[model samples]
Target: MSSSLLPFILFALVASISPGPTNLLILAHGAHNGLRASLAPIFAACAAAAAIVWVVGLGLGEVLLRHPLAQQVMSWVGVLWLSRLAWQLFRAAGEPLHATARQRFGVGSAASLQLVNPKVWLMAVAVIGVFATPGLPVWHLALVFLIIALPCMGAWALLGIGSARWLRSPRHLQRFNQLLALLLLVSAWSALLA
Candidate 1:
């Protein structure tokens, strides 16, 4: 790889793997639902992310960026939507987990979030703005992002699935859920600000 491209590779990896709301949701879901059940949301998030990269790389993001009113409206909606999800997760944390998993966040629900998630919007815009070149085919750049990002996102789910064996106690599990809830709440606020 060219040294010039190293930063983009590192940025994509770190950004995807970082504990944002999406990854946190994956972790929470995977921990409770097991790997098999968690597949829907994990793939949903990946699909949404890749879609973002594609749209932004194709320069459609400029249309949104040009319309500040549209951007602000989406940001507020994102805040409200995320706050609602965080509230539900927070309340769920109080309840003890059962052997049968509650499959709440499915493919449609998770994929729709990309529309309102400011972090996703920002990441997509930033990646294209910084790394995409005029000469390169936009889809190729988008594919690079997809290739690097999807697997990194999957790792968060893996961590959660792996932890299922370790956090066997009810109390430990409750605490973990509560903490994830708090983090998700914080992420929602941060997304609003971003």
Candidate 2:
């Protein structure tokens, strides 16, 4: 890769691996359900983010980037959605695990939710639009994103799985959930400032 490409790769990796709504939600899913259950959402999110990046890198994302109002709208929507998620986490802090089949993660709503997910949008705009050179062949950009996103999301899922061991206790799980929720809420608030 050329020297210019190196920065793009690093930016993609950092954006993809950093803590965000998708990561937190996946972690929660892994903890609440299991690693297997978390796979669906993780893969779905990865695919969705990749698709968005591809679209953005192709120039569609430019429209969004140029429109400040649209960006603000997205930011607010993300903040609201994350706030709602945080509330749910706060509420679930005291709940008991029923261990139902439906609780397991799957390629369902979670995957589709990436459409409205703010973190994914931010990533598409910041990394794909800003870092990825528009002149590059689309396939090359796609390949780079695929290589970077897959393992990064998997690492998050694995972290969640690892944390599950310590969250076995209902009380401990509850506290963890609450703390995670608080963090999410803080993230949402921070988004408003950004």
Q: Residue by residue across 53-116, what tens digits does model 2's lDDT show?
A: 7787777777886887987787787688778878977887876544422555456656655666
Which portions of model 2 show Cα errors greater than 4 Å?
A: 99-101, 104-106
| Model 2 worst lDDT run, 10 consecutive residues | 96-105
lDDT for position 77 in model 1: 92
Output the number of the TM-score-best candidate: 1
Worst 10 residues of 1 by lDDT: 94-103
Instruction: Give the Cα lDDT of each candidate.
Output: 0.78, 0.73
Q: Where does candidate 1 stray beyond 4 Å?
A: 1-4
Clashing pairs in 2: none
**Model 1 RMSD, rounded to 1 decimal:** 1.9
RMSD per candidate (Å) reads 1.9, 2.3
lDDT of 2: 0.73
